[model samples]
Target: MIGLKPPAIDRIALLAAHCDDIAIGAGGSLLTLCSARPGLRVDALVLSGGGTEREEEEHAALTAFCPGADLRLTVLKMPDGRLPANWDEAKAAVEDLRARTDPDLLFAPHPGDAHQDHRGLAKLVPTAFRDHQVLGYEIVKWDGDLGRPSAYQPLTPEVAEAKVALLQQHYPSQRQRPWYDREAFLGLARIRGIECHSRYAEAFHTNKLTLDLAGG
Candidate 1:
C-alpha cells in the first residue's frame, strides 16, 4: 500500500461526542504525533461529559496522549445519547471551535458511527470547517457499524502497547463497560493493522480530500 504524508502538522483538532472517544479512536496516533513534534497544538472538543468524573478522566487522558504538546480541551454538558435533541448547541460549539483554530488536520467521529451523538457531531463537522483534512475515526461498539476505512496510521508495537496502558490507567470510569478492555482495544488495532500491512494501526474514513501531487 502507498502512503501519503501530510504537511507538517503543528496544529490539530479533535472532535468527539464523549470523553474517551478521541483517545479510544486515535490515542496511538496522537502519541506518535506528539512524540515526533514537541509542543504540537491539540484542540479537543467533546459534546458531553462535562461537570462529571468523565471530564476529569478526559483531561488526564488527553494530557498523557498529547505529551509535551499544547492541549486545549472543552467538554460540554450535553446529555449523553441525546445529541439529536441538542442540535443547535452542538453546532454552535463546533462553530466556536472552528473560529478558534485553523487546524492542519481534524480528527472526528465518522458519520457512519453507530452512536447517534457521534453521527450527529460528524454531520456538523463539514458544516463549520469546509476546507480541511478531516479524518473520521472509528470506535468499536456493540452496534457493529465498522466500515472500510481509506486511511491508516500505523503504530509501532511499543506505541500500541503504551496506548492500551495509558487508556487503562486513565479512564477508570469506563472500566465498568464489558467492551472497554485491553483485548477489545488491541483486537481492533490488530485487525486494522492487517488491512494496512502493519502490526498495529488506527484506521480512518475521509469523505473528501484534495491531493496536491504537484507541489507549489
Candidate 2:
C-alpha cells in the first residue's frame, strides 16, 4: 500500500485574521477559479470578526466575490489583534483545520507585513501546514508594507475591476482609511504588472518555490 501521499494542491486554503483579509488578498483569484473550474474548492478562514454586523457583511461580500464557494468560509472567532499574545489557542485553531484538510495550496499574509496580526497569521500558516504549497499575499498597509514583489499574478481587467468593486461596495468600514481608494488598488496592480508584463496584477511573496525550468 502506498504511504500517505502528499495531498493534491487543487484544494486551496485562505487564512486571515480578519473578515476582509481573504477578499482583499485573493478575491480576484478566488472569483476566477471558482467560476472557471468546478473541481477546485476555496476555503476561507478568519480568526476574528468585527461583530455580528461585520460578519453579516463578510458573508455578503464573500458571496458576491466567490459566488460558487459556499460551505467554505469558517470564522474561528479568535482575538484579532492579539493572535501573537494568544499563540497557543491560535495555533490550535489552525492545527485543527490543517488536520482535517490537507489542501494543495494555502494563502496567508506575508510575515514581513506591517500589521502585527497579518504577520502573526502569516507565520502561523507555515507552522500548521508544513509541506503544502503556501503563498504569502501582501496587502497595502499604511505603515509602508509595500515592497518590490518578486512574484506576480496578472489580473484580468474584469478581475481587477471586480476586486476594486467588491472592496468598495462590500466593505464599508475599510473605506474610511485614507489609503483605501482607487489609487491604492490601481497603483499596486500597476506596479506589480510592470514586473510581469501586464497592465494589472496582484503581488505575493513566497518563501519556497520550486521552478520547473523545463516547462519554461
Candidate 3:
C-alpha cells in the first residue's frame, strides 16, 4: 500500500454520540498523535453522558488517551440513542464546536454507522466543517457495522496493549458489557493491522480528500 503522511497536525477535533465512543474508536490513534506532538490541542465533544458518572469516565479516559496535550472536552446532556429526535440541538452543538476551533483534522463517526445516533452526528459534521478533513472512526459492536476503511494508523505493540489496558482501567462503568473485553478490542485491531501491514492499527473511512501532490 502506498503511504501518505499527513501535514502538520497541531490541533484536532473529536466528535462522538456517546461517552466512550471516541475512546473505543480512536484511542490508539490519540495515543500516537498526542505523543508525537507534545501539547497538541485536542477538542472533544460528546452528545450524551453529561452530569453523570459516564461523563467522569469519559474525562479520565480521554485524558489518559491523550497524554500531555491540551485536551478540552465537552459532554452534552442530550439523550443517548435519541440524536435523531434532537436534530436541532445536535446540529447547534456541532456548529458551536466548529465556531470554537479551526482544527487541522476531525475524528467522527461514519455516515454508514448502523446506530442512528452515530449516523445522525456523522451527517451533522459536514454541515458545519465543510473544508476540514474528517476521519470517520469505527467502533466494533454487535451491530456489525464495521466496513472496509481506506485509511490506517498503524500502532506499535506497546501502544496497542496500552490502549486496551487503559480502556479497562479508566472505564469501570463499561466493564459489565459483554463485548467490552480486551479480546474484542485486540481482535479488531489485529485484523486492521493485517490489512495495513502492521502488528496493530486503527482504521478510518473518509468521504472526500484533496491531495497536494505538487507540495504546495
Candidate 4:
C-alpha cells in the first residue's frame, strides 16, 4: 500500500485519460519525491493528449514539475471525450503500462469525477495494478464532482504556490476555463488543510486502505 515508508517504492505510475491529470492530482508530491530522492523513477502515462502542441507543453510542464526524478512520459493517442467508445484500446494501454513497470504506487483520477475520460481511467487502473497501492486524487472542477475526501496530504505554503504557478505558467490553453484559477487550487487546499489541521493540503480517497493502528 502507499504510505510514508520506503520499500522499493522508487517506481511510481501516474496514469490518466488526459494530459493534465497527473499534474492536477499528485504534482506537489511528485515534486517533493523527485527532489528528495535521487534516481527516483516515475512513469507518467496519459491515455490521450498526443500529436498536438498541447503535448509539447505537457512534456515541458511535467519535466519542470518532477525535477530530479527519472521521469518517462507516454501519451496515448486515444480519443478524448470518447473513452467509452474506445474501451479495449484504453484497457490494453493500462495493461501494457502495468506489465512494464509493476509500479509500487499509482496515482489516478477519482472515479467519481464527472468527466467520462477521468472516470474511465479510474476504473481501468485497478484492473491493471491489482497489487499496487492506488490513490485517487481530485481535480477541482465546476462540474460539482468534488466529493468528501478521506485522506490528506499537508502542503507547505511554498509547495502550494509552486503547484499553482506551474499550472498557470505551463497550461495556458486551460486558463480560460472558469475552474482553472489559482483560487480553485488554493481554496481547495485550504479546505482540506482545515480537515487535517495543516496550513494547506491536498485530499484523496481510496476504496481500500491499509492502516497499522496497532503501532499507535
Candidate 5:
C-alpha cells in the first residue's frame, strides 16, 4: 500500500459521543502523534459522562494517551445513547469546540457507525469543521460495523501494546464489558495491520481529502 503523510499537524481535535469512545477508537494514533510532536495541542469534546466517574476516567485516560501534549478535554452530560434526541446540545458543543481551536486534523467516529450516538456525532462533525481533515475512527463492537478503511496509521509493536495497556489500565470501569479485553483490541489491530502490510495499525475512514500531488 502507498503511504501518505499530512504536510503539517501542529494541532488536532477529537470528538466522541461517549467518554471512552476516543480512546477505544484512536488511542494508538494519539500515542503515535503526540509522542512524535511534543506539546501538540489536542482539544477534545465528549457528549456524555460529565461530572461522573466516566468523565474522570476519560480525563485520566486521555492524559495518558496524549502523553506530553497540551490536552484540553470537555465531557458533557448529554444522556448516553440519546445523542439523536439531544441533537441541539451536541451540535452546540461541537460548534463551541470549533470556536476554540483550529486543528489541522480531527479524529471522530465514522458516519456509518452502527451505534446511534457515534453515528450522530460523526454526521455533525462536517457541519462545523468544514475544510479540516477528519479521520473517522472505528470502534469494534458487538454490532459488527467495521468496514474497509482507506487510511491506516501503522503502529510499532511497542506502541500497540502500550495502547492496549493504557486502555486496560486507565478505564477500570470498562473491564466488566465482555468485549473489552486485550485480545479484542490486539486482534482488531492485527487485522488492520494485515490490511495495510504492518504488524499493527489503527485504521480510519475519510469522507474528503484535498491532495497536493505537486508537493508544493
Candidate 6:
C-alpha cells in the first residue's frame, strides 16, 4: 500500500454531538497529529453539554488531546438526543463554526451513526464544509453501529496508551457508563490496527476525497 502524506495540515476542525465523542472516536489520531505538528490550530464544536461540568471536562480533554495546538472549542446547550426537533439550531451552530475557520482536515460523526443527534449533525457537515476533507468518526455503542470504516490512522502503542489514559483522566463524568473502560477502548483500537496492519489504530469513514497524485 502506497501511503500518501497530507500536505501540511496547520488547521483542523472537530465536531461532535456530545462530550467525549471526539475523544472516544479519534483521540489517538489527535495525539499523533498534534504531537507531531506542535502548535497546530484545532477548532472543536460540540452540540450539547454546554455551560455545565461536561463542558469543562470537554475543554480539558480537548486541550489534553491537542497537546500544543491552538484549540478553540464551542459547546452548545442544545438538548441531548433531540437534534431532529432542533434542526435549525444545530444547522446554525455548524454553519457558524464553518464561517470561523478554513481547516485542512475535519473530524465529525458519521452520518450512518445510530444516535439521532450524531447522525443529524453528520448530515449537516457536508452542507457547511463542502470543499474540505471530512473524515467521519465512529462511536461504539449498544446499537452495534460500528460498520467497516474506510480509512485508518495507525497509532503507536505509546500514543494509544496515552489516548486511553487521557480519556480516563479527563472525563470523570462519563465513568459510570458500562462501555467506558480501558479494555473496550484499547480492544477496538487493536482491531482497527489489525485492519490497517499496525499495533493500534483509529478508523474513519470518508464520504469523498480528491486525489492529487500528480503533486506527489
How would you encode candidate 2's per-residue C-alpha lDDT over 1-216 as one tens digit per residue?
Answer: 111222333677888888888787777767776676555766777788745566777878888876665437777667768888988877887898897787777878888988988888788888888887776888877688777656666788888888898989988977898988878887887788787888888877877866554654
> After superposing candidate 3, which stretches have Cα over 4 Å from the reference?
none
Per-residue lDDT of model 6, residues 1-216, tens digit only: 456688999999999999999999999999999999998999999999999999999999999999999999999999999999999999999999999999999999998999999999999999999999999998888999999999999999999999999999999999999999999999999999999899999999998878987895
Across 15-94, the per-residue lDDT of candidate 3 in tens digits comes to 99998899999999999999999999999999999999999999999999999999999999999889988999999999
Number of backbone-clashing residue pairs for each candidate, in the order shown: 0, 1, 0, 0, 0, 0
Q: Predictions ranked by lDDT, top down? A: 3, 1, 5, 6, 4, 2
Query: RMSDs, each prediction?
Result: 0.7, 5.3, 0.6, 2.5, 0.6, 0.8
The residue-level lDDT of candidate 5 at 54 comes to 94
Model 6: clashing residue pairs? none
Candidate 6, position 87, lDDT? 99
What is the C-alpha local distance difference test score of candidate 2?
A: 0.77
Q: How does candidate 3 score on lDDT?
A: 0.96
RMSD (CA, Å), candidate 4 to true, equals: 2.5
Error of 1 at 54 (Å): 0.6
What's the TM-score of every candidate structure? 0.99, 0.88, 0.99, 0.93, 0.99, 0.98
Compared with the true structure, all predictions reach lDDT values of 0.96, 0.77, 0.96, 0.83, 0.95, 0.95
